[model samples]
Target: MFTYEISPVFILMEEVVLRKMHSIIGWPEEDGDGIFCPGNNTMSNLYSVLLARFHLFPAVKTHGMSVIPRLALFTSEHSHYSIKKSAAVLGIGSENVIVIRRDERGKMISSELNSSIVAGLVPFYVSATAGTTVCGTFDPLNEIVDICEHHGLWIQNDAQWAALLLRTNQEVIHYHNRLQRAMCCSQGLLQECNQLCAEYLFQPDKHYDVSYDTGDKRIQCGRHIDVFKLAFEAQINHCLENAEYLYYKLKRTDFKLVFKGKVNKVNFFCCVFSNPATQREDVDFLIDEIACLACEL
Candidate 1:
């Protein structure tokens, strides 16, 4: 129901690079971004990396690597350069940022990582990509997290693009509820996706206290709850309720969706509304028709 356009750099960072954060219901900074970081951009979220490292070794603040031993950072080859950039800025030269090999599907090869660890590298941190760039594949977080925990390595999850998938799910679930209320006069097409509907997302749904979601208790500063919170949260939940709407909508229509409904999570939905009989005039007419229909309501 709402959209925001920040900047080319920030938007591109969110689309292709970084991710996460938020909490606290108190007085947040107003009128300026000075209040809180959306963490929707690369640079904004990268601050967490610096914070984690600094917290691990407080001396790194006043003294530059004088007290700490030789340290390295490991991340997947498919990961964004944001980690390396943070390293470079934090006095850990880019050379210390090791790139682990990834499999054909763009997932980090855990075996290769084991070999790297065996090769005598003292890693201070290991970043895992929950969702990757380019191929939109996800690295094996279970393996990566296990490795990092065993080695006392700080883990960072770049889950920016994954957040968008939450939106697609939200839209479908919301629309379907409206249809069930019989509010959609011409929405019989909504049922076309009943097969695609999913009762659960990747994990089985269980009734648990939601407070446990952010119980990590990391040194994260509270963010001003963005105005988009409630609606977007509803949209995120929509993923669970109406997972089939978009897939079935395009399947039953003349429009062809890129990727043909095959995506780990629907990130970039490139739709080609190509039709041999459609004319340039039809585009404007369709917009007019939609406007008139909206007015009819």
Candidate 2:
């Protein structure tokens, strides 16, 4: 059982960090909206779907699922299972979530996505994968975007791995801008969808700016201040560099690689380099350990 007491200071810090994140993701500073979630990417995925649902069918918020048609959302087979989990939790039914086929590299095939959009189910959202879970493959965004735009669907880029790339690589900045509605985690639309406006906590007649009271934006009453941790970890380039070093080393070794290329090329192996403290020597040691273990097998 986890709980936290939300404070005004925490809310201010969250807004600052979220705005910085938006800027880094290539959104104009004040254009996008976001909120910090107490859970992981799964929770974030759920929140994104919730926002999309509310965006498309605002009536569902008050009238319940009965008001809406048999709604459907789209995601790749290689995409996170959280999408399906989100569907279930939102009463959309897991079976209703149409799975689009992926290519050999584990990316959502745009043609298949286009073909999948039929008449019966009301397709309102598409959860495009920025970096997939197992293969680390990024779905073709340019193609996906064209289809999403034509179909008039809300696009949510599940860029859980994007922060690392945005910090280390500049080339992706252009590609990121094409994302229409939301990216990564929660969005500003969240406030509209989930705000309860509980009088005691979020009184509008307060002395301070009441909008700073971000806690009411979440379904949870007590939210852990996770934004502080994100703000503190400002150095991530070295971590990516170390991972790249390891990637090359593993390529030269006898170990059978799952995916032979980097993220942009085709696919990437999940070699975590998240810890800022990881060094070249540590990568070397890991490679050596893998080689030794291979010899045993």
Winner by lDDT? 2
Give the residue spans of candidate 1 off by over 4 A.
1-41, 119-121, 165-297
| Alpha-carbon lDDT, every model | 0.48, 0.73
- What's the TM-score of each model vs. the native? 0.49, 0.85
- Per-residue C-alpha lDDT of model 2 across residues 1-297, encoded as one tens digit per residue: 011134656666667766765676677775777766655578778888888889888999989999999988999999899999999999998998999988777899999999998899999888887778776788888788788889998777777676446534543545632332223333467678888788776677877666677666677756667665455334566766786787788778775566554334534336766688888998889878867886899
Q: How does candidate 2 fare on TM-score?
A: 0.85
lDDT of prediction 1: 0.48
Residue range with the least summed lDDT across 10 consecutive positions in model 2 = 176-185
